[model samples]
Target chain A: ELKVEQNPLFLSMQEGKNYTIYCNYSTTSDRLYWYRQDPGKSLESLFVLLSNGAVKQEGRLMASLDTKARLSTLHITAAVHDLSATYFCAVAYTGTASKLTFGTGTRLQVTL
Target chain B: DTAVSQTPKYLVTQMGNDKSIKCEQNLGHDTMYWYKQDSKKFLKIMFSYNNKELIINETVPNRFSPKSPDKAHLNLHINSLELGDSAVYFCASSPNQGTEAFFGQGTRLTVV
Candidate 1:
């Protein structure tokens, strides 16, 4: 069974602060994804890290993958109030499969 | 337009009743999946279909059946619904296996 774990399941940071959420998986995966979800809305894709050392950034968020270490990270730069949401790291099944094993999620609460 | 959409955003029903949630993606993806989010907010894969062929079937109960009529459509039908079945169900699709997936807004299933 592949297990995906996220550290600091709950995080509260003030606006303009920086923090990183870690995602560690138990097995090798072909790809990893970062997603964000509001309290009552659907998940929105943030980044897709497809290879080792792959890093992607969008606005105040950056995601990187270290496949060799079976880990991924989502870093927030200068967090803002709108960044308050649940962030999830999902690992894709190996080979040509679309199934995903998701982490426990990190609920971020950015305040002033 | 919604890339992936699931009908009946909210469903409330009595136990033992049968219900189905519909999902359709207009993104022309070849693979679709069904995921369940429990109260604790842990997301788990339930079923996956690639080009209308059953590809991944998680250890979900037999009462939950997933049907895919086409590459762009997948539906989950639950019979003899139990209280444990209450959760937020999401439908997702990807252009191919091991790729970024677009998710639906999710259907909140509530069993009374």
Candidate 2:
């Protein structure tokens, strides 16, 4: 079974601070995804890392994937109140369908 | 227009009742998935279908049944609902096994 784990399950950071959320998987998967979910809302796709060393950045959020190590990371360059949400990293193993195994989400709370 | 959409954004019902959640995607995707998010915020994949064929079924209870009538529609029917079944259910789809998925607004099921 493929397992995905994330660190700092809950993060509380002040605005303007920087933090990184780590995602580690138990199996080899070239496809990794990052998603953000606000309170009482559906998940929103953040980044899709398709290859080892692939990195994507949008605004203050950047995501990178390392397939060899079975790890991925979501880096927050500068935190803002708007960035407060639960972030999840999912690993996909290609079979008949790309089954996604999501990591334990990191709930981030950015305060003033 | 919403790429993916789910009916009954919120549902509240008594235990032992049966309920169904409907999902539809207009993105012309070939794969659809159902995920459950618990109160603790843990997300798990319950079922997946590709091209109207069942492809992935996780270790979910038999009471939870998923039906894909077509390539664009997937419905979940829960029989004998229990308190533990109370959670937010999200429906998502991707173009194929190698692309990023688009998620629908979740259906929050609350069992009393």
Candidate 3:
């Protein structure tokens, strides 16, 4: 059984603040993904981390993976109101076709 | 154009009724998946198809059956629906296993 855990299941941050969401998995995986979802909407892909020390940044969000530690992080730099949503991290083990085990999402609410 | 799309963005039905949700991807991806997001926002994998073959089948109820007529389409049919089946069902696709997945807008199912 692959277990995925996320910290701070709910977060409320002020605009322009910085925060990091952590994702930890119980087993080694070939890839990890970060996704964002708004209320009543499906998930949108944020980043794909394929290797250790891989980091990707888009706009105010940056995601990094540390495969050795079986951990991944999604960092928000200078959060804005539009960044309010639910974030999820999923892991795909080797030899699987999108059989991802997702973490309990972290709901983020950024206010002015 | 939508890369991935699901029909019936919202569905409200009575228990014991049978219903089906349709999904199609235009990205030319070889793999497709169905995920369930529960009330607590826990996303879990239900089924996956690769090149029209059932690749991964999670421990979902037998009433929930997935059909893939072609490489680009996957449909989910649920019989004898229960209250617990009320959740957002998402359809996603990727070029291959362990790749970044593109998701559809999701179908919100409500059983009363």
Candidate 4:
């Protein structure tokens, strides 16, 4: 069974502050994804890290994957109030079925 | 255009009622999935469909059933809804099994 764990389930930050959310999986997987969800809204794709040492960035958000360590990280640089949302990291095992196991989301609250 | 879409953003129904949520993806992807998010913010995979074939079926209750009429749509039907079934349901699609998925806005199901 594959299990995903995320750190700092709840985060409160001041505007313009930086933070990083960590995601660790119990098994070996090569694909990782980061998604953001606002209250009462569906998830928005943030990043997709497909290989070892793969990193992707968009605006103030960056995501990296380390396949050897079975870990992924989503770094938010200079977060704004608009960035306040619940973030989740998911792991997909490399196979034909390709089902994703999701982590317990980290709820971020950014105050102005 | 919306890449992925789900019907009935909010659903309120009584226990033992039967309900269905419709999902469609215009991204021309070959894989679609159903996920449930509980109150604790834990997102779990309920079903995965690839090319209209069932792929991954997680440890979900028998009341929950998924139907993929075509490659672009996957619908979820729940029977004898219980209070525990009140949660957000998401529909997603990916190009293949190991790729990043595009998600719908989600349906918030409230079992009264």
Kept native contacts, as fractions per model, are: 0.85, 0.71, 0.83, 0.81
What is the C-alpha lDDT profile of model 2 across B28-96, one tens digit per residue? 999999999999999998988999998888889999999999999999999999999999999999988
What is the C-alpha lDDT profile of model 1 across A1-112, one tens digit per residue?
A: 7899998899999999999999999997859999999998999999988889999999999999998899999999999999999999999878655578899999999999
Q: Which candidate is the best by lDDT?
A: 1
**Cα miss at B89, model 1 (Å)?**
0.4
Off by over 4 Å in 3: A96-98
* Alpha-carbon TM-score of each model against the true structure: 0.97, 0.97, 0.96, 0.95
Residue A92 displacement (Å), model 2: 0.4
The fnat score for candidate 3 comes to: 0.83
What are the per-model DockQ values?
0.81, 0.73, 0.76, 0.81
Error of 3 at B22 (Å): 0.6
Q: Which ten-residue region of model 2 chain A has the weakest summed lDDT?
A: A92-101
- lDDT of each residue in A1-112, candidate 4, tens digit only: 8899999899999989999999999988988999998988888888888889999999999999999999899899999998999999989877667788889999999999
- Provide the lowest-lDDT 10-residue window in model 3 chain A: A92-101
In model 4, which residue pairs have backbone atoms overlapping below 3 Å? Answer: none
TM-score of chain A of 3: 0.96
Which run of 10 residues does model 1 chain A get worst, by summed lDDT?
A: A92-101
A92: Cα error in model 1, Å: 1.1
lDDT tens digits, residue span B1-112, model 1: 9899999999999999999999999999999999999998999989989999998889899999999988989999999999999999999999987688889999999999
